[model samples]
Target: MKILLLLLTVSVVMAQAQAPHIDSSYSDGQIQAFLKDGFERNDRLLQAKAYYLLAAREQNGGINNEYTITYLQKSHELFAASRDAYHLHRAKLALALSYVDQKTFDQAFDLQREALTYFEQRNDLFMATHAAASLANTYKLMGNLPQERVYLERCETNNKLLKDNILSLAILNSKVVNFQRQRQYDQALSAAHQLLTIARASKKTNFEIAGLFFEGILHQFKGQYQTAIGKLFDCLSLISNPNLSPEAMQCYLHLSQCYEALHDYPHAYQYSQRYGQASHAILNNQRQTALQRQTLRFDAEGKRRQIANLEKEKREAEQTALWQRTITIGIGIAAFVLFCALFSVLYFHRQKTRSDQIIENQKEEIKQKEINELRQELTLQNVQAIVTGQETERERIAKDLHDSLGGMLSTVRLRFDALKTGQPTHAYEQALDMLDNTIREVRHIAHNLQPDALLQFGLTAAINDLVNRTHSPATPDINFQTYGQEFALTPTQSLTIFRIIQELLYNAIKHAKASEILVQLNWQTPSLMILVEDDGVGYDTTQIQTGMGTKNIQTRVAYLNAHLEVQSVPDEGTTVVVTVGV
Candidate 1:
């Protein structure tokens, strides 16, 4: 009995491992119709198969596992009652998978063993290999390394017997994972390399990527930071499916750690941030998907109830018509007229209900849009706060240098001049000149940190001063213009605008190599507009890499609830326009 149980358990595991992929192209309505047709035909086998397919579809759609379990149970019953051992085993295997999902490991193990026995009796080496692999995974999950190793070896041996290199490669991949878990890096690396070679030769992109990921992990464990980074990046470039999010998340996290170990704090921080954002996005997407699936299931259930009620009403009408037929002609005419009136009333009520439903749906859509807008607003506000904090810090630093450091330097120069009373020597003149240059350089640095003109004279004068400073015979000819009525703005708004203009000018001069630049600030009654144009060799905006300057500009613009437009064509001038409600 124990041997039989073990065999059954194996069969169940294999069945789950070999579950067919659900084709998402088919609509839920079509699947339901197919199932209904099978049931109406009273073909038990067909009904069982249909139910199994439905379960698979539900599983793939990420619907509640209980729904899948219900379908699988029905399929299993039908197959068992029909005494179709082969199909019954398949049903059992599917049921085991559902049980596994529900964390009923004992039941799953029992079903898997049964499935294995069935496959072995039929001399099905491929399925037997799949069963062994599943068993290995189960053991791994249970933390029974010895048992896991035994099954993994069995899986590989069976794959070899079947003469399937792809199956063998899969087993090898699993072994690599097991080896990694055991901290046997050498074995893991060896297996990963073999898997990669086979996967590449077979043109299996997914397996090849997986192989690359394993290689990266092995290298990371060996403290080969550079090699690991390259391998991990390669894996990331090849991953397109959201299902591989966990792998991608690991890559990002490990890359962050590797960079940190190498004392590259900036790269480390960047990767860590990427990992956090990716993880949040993945979780959000999963939550939304699950909610959508639940909504769809509820809708389907409501439709089914409506259909059942309609059928019930139709049956009653048929019976009433039969009774009416037996009545006299006069009564029959009256009955027919009464029926027409009742039908009209029912139709009118249905139409009214449908209209109400439509209105409700529209309301829900509008509410969802409002919620999304609020979320975006909150995100922008957070970014604005960060930018504000950074600017405030810069201002503080500038103030310190201007007041404390500048004052001390000036006092030092005064003392030096007072001490040099006697000799008008060459050394004294050179020392005076050096001291003057140092003071000028310090002032320039302080001004750049938080421009004094921007704080004292507001946005227009600051922009004008900036234009004049950037204007040189060797540099581009920058033109500044103002239009509309000049209006007052809060200091924060003025500062943000000034910084944006500064970045734009810097980009034009340094990157674009412009010969001519125009800066315009227009303040109307309720709005403010700024435009910066440069006659320079532009770039492909789509391919433009967003640097710190661009990011800062984006943050400030979002904070101001503004619109920004940039038009750039290769070999032509670039124009950037920003409009904000005052």
Candidate 2:
């Protein structure tokens, strides 16, 4: 009975000690007690997260890097279990920044790019912008100004629409520094002013301080020694020491530049020494971290050998598995071939009928092209006749203007000059208004003769203006829409598209008396498709002999190496679709 009681008591104590921990029990004492027992455990993931949370709180501004890095490294190791792209990206970004803060610029730059690639592939623009900003800082620290500018521009491009106010202003500030580095005083000062404006407009403290420091640095670069010193002093007074790393480093460097230029040897030497000390400390920290990495790498190498041996054994086992999979796939392929052989009998019968239709289609296309060429010849002749008639009409108008309006305008101007210089007469004003109206009318006629705006502005804008002006208030509705990316085209291509739309719309409104029109330009697969649709009297396409308008369109389409399709009904509507490689 005594032995039984002792055994029972020991078993109860062991069971109590092995009790599972219940997370989120809302008991701080229990958590502290649990942590006090051991910092490490069998569950690496749990231990890593715990150490991470603790190290984050214990960093206290990175005063003790030994403890901080140890925890970060452990957290990094356990992150492999997550094996997610975003998690890896986050860990790599954090490690890179830590490297940057420690002044390990080369390694920081390399790792930052790796993080950036993952963000870019996922189209996570916000994180990409942040990564680019960090990359810019790393490049600048390494004295690679051009590379730094490239990264800053990327940051700006990504955040242009996001309106991450602080980041946007920082990008501008970085560009100003780049300009100053190149000794572009006027441009640099302008950029600096722009940065200050952006930062103030954003109403962010960090951005505002960044702007002010950069503004002062601009003055220092411009040889305004005393002004630069005062501004730098103002910046220093404005920010607390804890918020001082980036700006303070800049201040020291710029002041050293200013003092050395002004021949203040002692002050220059003192600042140079200060810079050396700060830089040396940063470098020493990096060296220690590198040594730690090297030690980890040596340890990892031994682990890698062990892993290789295990992998060899695993691979040997996998070979037989792979062979079995291959055999299974071979059987699937053989079965697929049998099914295909049975399918081919029906497929061949269908293909024979399709081949006949394809040949007929080709013949029809060739005939259409020949017909189009003949119609274009006739349209060219018509255009020549129209031009000749217009010129004669214009000559008649010019002769009238020279003989009639010229004399009247000369007489009126002479009479007006007879009056006092500042005197106004209602009669005179009325006569002037009359003359202005006539001049405007004449200009309108000339514009109808030849449109310069159509030539200067793009095809779409020109067509839109034409539709607005020509469409009567009581006339049928005209809807115009566009899609795909717009880019600069050669003047001739623009003119051709404009002319085609004008001719098509004119034919629809005048000949067909169309009640409605829909003009659409869009990307259809790899080519651009322009469709003009109207509801009006439609002709049988069987009467395929091309008219003048049809000929002009066909000519333009040929010039563009495009395809055109026309579908029409007797009373429903006519739709014209043209596809061009654009």
Candidate 3:
């Protein structure tokens, strides 16, 4: 009987091991069947192996975090209970990964450290190095740069000790990320080049793609946009699963940024849209996984309850049979009790089904809401871009009017004065009068479009002129104040800021009907702050619509890459503040 039990256990273990195929193409149904079979066998090693396989498969399939963590936890417990050191460490490592996926960095780090310690104690250099690498990754995620570097160094040391180039390649990959995070571009580039060379030497497609992606990122950081684009495209071309792979998503994002940097706005927008879609898809997948996890947990609990009740019924029936062996009525009573138990089970099962259906409906509603929100956000961004473009064109037209039309008119006036003698014809005098009026109008229009003071004399003079011009007997008592030293700014920055101030003043006068307005400009060496305040009937900010003037102000603020704050309340004065890097 002992030999037979040993043989049966071995068979079960082997069967469990063979159940979940390692092939990437294996179906989820097959994996579920294997897990069910192994679990039903109730052998420790077999169950542990089955759990590990399920975790691995779920991870590869991008299934929800709960299931992965559940399987890993189960596997860890079984492996530890069975005293299987090798498999226990594997289970711990897998558990650490699940923790990482769930962003539980502290837990991940602890588990990885335990695995590392175990491997080192066993002199398992290969797994020890891998564990060290994982620890490094967890540290990176935790934003502990120094600690990350420390573990990475340890990983390199072990890899070198093992004389394993492939293991060392992983170290190099981590170095690229580490150096990139530190903004050590030269070091990052060198590491990426080395990684590419090694990956090519290994002739591994995935590693090669990863190397290219890293190189692309390094080039992008170095401002070699075109070269970065080339490398990223090469990486993309080799990517088999763009939606599922983090690297591919990163590639899409980097490509978008690279195109934007190159001034290829159309392509940039296209890639950016793709990046957004891919990100949304990933998030949706995570949400679905979370929901699935909840469903699974519910189902498991329901099964446990069913099993417990059934066991109780069986015990009761056995007791009844013992008491009623001589009485046939006792058999009837047991049968009736069993029927009642079955009915209760069925009723509870129906309730569980209804609950599941409700949860699924809620999940669907949340998913739809998220999708709609994402769509609306994308639409807003697109509209904002168009508005920005329109503002840019207005600035350009204003500059053209000031430089070309205004200059031409001034030239003509100069010629007319030169040609004038002691007496002038009535038509020539009328023409001169018309010309004067036209010149004034042209100047006014040009100033409205793009302020000359902003372009020529910088922000301080421009703002002072704006306040002075806007202040009159009929208008608000506008006060202009300046603090700190005035500094030079790029034309684009100056115009954007000027436009923002103009919009704020215009809004205050037209909408707020203010009695007094204060405009303040403060220039600290590397930054500028603009404050505009008005004592007027302020409207509710939440009720403010995205009108052209408001949109223009927003566009200009964005163009300057500045922070804008608008505070207003009914019956309270409005205040607008802007801050920008100088």
**Candidate whose lDDT is highest:** 1
lDDT per residue for candidate 3 within 1-582, as digits (tens), equals 111111111122223335442323334445454555554554567667766776775665556468679878988998888898888887888788788878988788788888899989999876777687777777787788778889878877776667765665667777888889999999888988888898789876766887899889889989999999999999998988888777778888999999899899999999899888889888898899779877766665564355345446656766877677747777788998999988998899999999999999999999999999998787767755765676688778878887899899999999998887765688789989999989988888777876767767788888888887777688988888999998888775676788788889988888888888898998998999999999899888888788989987886777566899999887889999999986
lDDT tens per residue, model 2, 1-582: 111111111121211222322211212223233333333234444444444443343332343355445556656676666454564565566667667768877777787898889889998887777677778777777788888789877877887777665556656767877777877778777877777787678776566676678678777766688888877777667667622254666677777888999999889887777666666666776789778776655654464354345446546656877899999999999999999999999999999999999999999999999999989877766655654464457557755665566557656667766773667677767877787667656555455444557667776677787777668776667888888765666665666677678778877887676778888878555677789899988878888578888887887777666788999988888999888786
Ranking by lDDT: 1, 3, 2
Better of 1 and 2 by lDDT: 1
Off by over 4 Å in 1: 1-41, 240-246, 300-582
Q: Which is better, 2 or 3, measured by lDDT?
A: 3
TM-score of every candidate relative to the true structure: 0.46, 0.36, 0.41
lDDT of 3 at 282: 86
All-Cα superposition RMSD per candidate: 31.5, 23.6, 31.9
Write the candidate numbers in order of decreasing TM-score.
Answer: 1, 3, 2
Clashing residue pairs, backbone N/CA/C < 3 A, model 3: none
TM-score of 2: 0.36
lDDT of 1 by residue, 1-582 (tens): 111113323322212212222222344555555555554555566657667767766665666467678888988998887788877877777787678667788988998888888888899876665566666766777777778789888776776666766676677777888889899999999999998999899988877888999999899999998999999999898889633387788888989998998999999999998889889888988898879988878875764565355446646766777677757667878999999898998999999999999999999999999999999988987887897898889889888888999898999999988889786688898998999989987887788779888878878999998888767798888989999877889988888888889999988988888889999988887999999999899989999999988988888898888999999999998999999898
Clashes of each: 18, 0, 0
User: After TM-score superposition, what is the CA distance of residue 313 in candidate 1 from its true location, in Å?
Assistant: 13
Show the lowest summed lDDT stretch of 10 residues, model 2. 1-10
